[model samples]
Target: MERKRGWDTLLSADTHHNAVGLLAREMRRASSPLYYPIALCLLRLLTREKTSWELPAMAFLVEALDCPDMTEWSDSILEILSRRLWSQCTEMHRLVLRGLVLLSKAPGMADGVRSLTPSLVELLCYTGGELVGMVLSVLINQVQDRDIPISTPTALRLAELLPPLFGYDNIHVQLLSIYLFQKVMELAVDKSKQLLKTHVIYSLLPLFFHWHHENQDVAEASRKALLRAAGLLKRRDLVKLLKTEQPWRFSECLLENDKRRAVEYACQALPYLESPQEPVREAALRFIGIAGRYMRGQRVELQVAINVIEDMTPDSAAVKSLALQTQEILRAVQRPQSSPGSSSLKISSRRCRIGRLLSGAAAGGQRRTYSGNPV
Candidate 1:
């Protein structure tokens, strides 16, 4: 009674740090009598509206979370952390991640925190390398087990997010994200496999390009992921080429097999042009050249690729040369086709416009039209 009185007094007196620490230490020391109320008090503190109650309270909860046998409190603690993880406060984010990482290490807690997967997946797109690595680390743990079976909804979103991170600057981030992507594809609920099919298919080119990444571990992970992705896609030819490490064939195979999305695929490769690695940029440009052949006369799509490639004033002679070659090929495909009768069609269309204007002027004498349609 006296200890509770002292704790309430300190909180009421604004002993933010010292009092929270005092209570947390007591919880850890005497888990017998005082653990329940103090721990519950800290959990409730996370719900308080007072900004003063946030940092230290979160710190206290995170500290207490590091101990083992949190089975009883795992759900509540995870619930609190997951809710606060979306907070804009960086300090709160760090503490929430630390608490999550610790909890994720516990067996069976993976499901307790699995609902946070989509939010964490989006976090991979943000700036902090350490934060990205932490998010990937937690994700890798959550879905690593083959039996876990990520929900269909989470798996679809995961497929969308992981493709861009294959080129993330951090090595560990790259490896874990790719590997986790593979696991998500493998363990996603079977009923929704068809729903995830297109996402898996789109990932192939990115995964194929990354397989050539200079880092052997990243390269190997990409290869493994590509193989699994191929299996999901049921492309026996890709599987055979992968078995022989012949990624050189992925482009022709990709463009030949998925021509409907050829323009979209070319657009997908657009971002890789800016990759810091020359090899990756080289691959993206080369693929754009091939994609151009399939995109014949898709002027807007073709010009978008041409413009983005032209925008890069690369330091490498090879990349610059390839960019020019790709633009020339895409521009050639972008040109309008000539035929025996096309010029008369243009003359007739012009006559039709003039005839419409004359009839409108005859009908409504006040009707007006502008000739400044730009020469």
Candidate 2:
């Protein structure tokens, strides 16, 4: 009774210097049962004051209250701290998050902290790397233990929250964000599985090709996650993903496992041959050259390849060389019974005619024409 009276007297005093020091000292000496009421009083003071002094007092109390055996006390503390998370005082908000972090580490306390997911995720949008890292660390622990997977609703909410972090400037934030995503990928099942694959995969595509990421671990993790996702995709989806101007960048990763699929992927590269970006055009042409053997019976595909190749200027030596090589392969496949020497002569004749047509078109002397032959 006297101790409670002392606390009340200190709190009621106009100057908080005496109360703050006394609370800090008592929190350290207080026995297990004494922590609950002390925590309540500290919370009450923090709620009422929002003073710098109260912030440290509450932090001290949180440290004292942090213990695995005190689940009920931890629960109460978390409940009060969660409310204080919305406090406009930045220092108070930070101290509360720190308290939550410490409490989250206690055994069996994650379940209680799990209720803070919505608030924590909302906090992520505006917080700095330090707080963001702490929040994510807590969340990572929440979903990581197999015996106690985070609820599906919370998992899905986390998935929705993760996409933007991919673009954050902080490397730690980016890496932790990806780690959380990888965990979700491993944990999601049933309907949640469909949600992650459909909504999250698109956002992850850019990361797959982050080959220049300064951190090799992040780059490697991105590659593993992308390949894992690729394994889940169908041939049609792979082709659809390749329809962009730079499909070749991902082709080796996405289609290399299957030869027939790689050939079909090459067919999709035809449109990219005209891409304004030199690298895109070059990769498209190179893919066609490698897959030329499969273009034997693909007459329309061969013609498209030949037409795009013929459009290239002589200055683009790399593109023209690959184009001619691809045309030669198509010619050999067209006439399997013919001798190599004859095929070479035929290729030379076709090249001369195509060159004349190109020069004429360049000179505005005549409209370009196609023989529509495989060559």
For model 1, the run of ten residues with the poorest summed lDDT: 366-375
How does model 1 score by TM-score? 0.72
Give the distance in Å from residue 7's predicted Cα in candidate 2 to where it truly belongs.
Answer: 23
How do the residues 46-91 of candidate 2 rate in per-residue lDDT, one tens digit apiece? Answer: 5555564665576556655554444655656776688788777665
Give the TM-score comparing model 2 with the true structure, all chains together.
0.53
Candidate 1 per-residue lDDT over residues 1-375, each given as its tens digit: 245564664655344554665666666776646665556687766655546667778767777775654467777788788787877877678778878888877776876777777788778666376777788788877755536888888888888888878887888888988998889878889976889898898888788778767777887899899999888889888888788765655677878888888999998899888877666676777778778768876889988898898898555765575677667767766777656667987756654553453333222211111121100
**If scored against the real structure, what TM-score would every candidate get?**
0.72, 0.53
- Candidate 1 positional error at 348, Å: 33
For candidate 2, what's the RMSD? 14.1
In model 2, what lDDT does residue 261 have? 54
Clashing pairs in 1: none
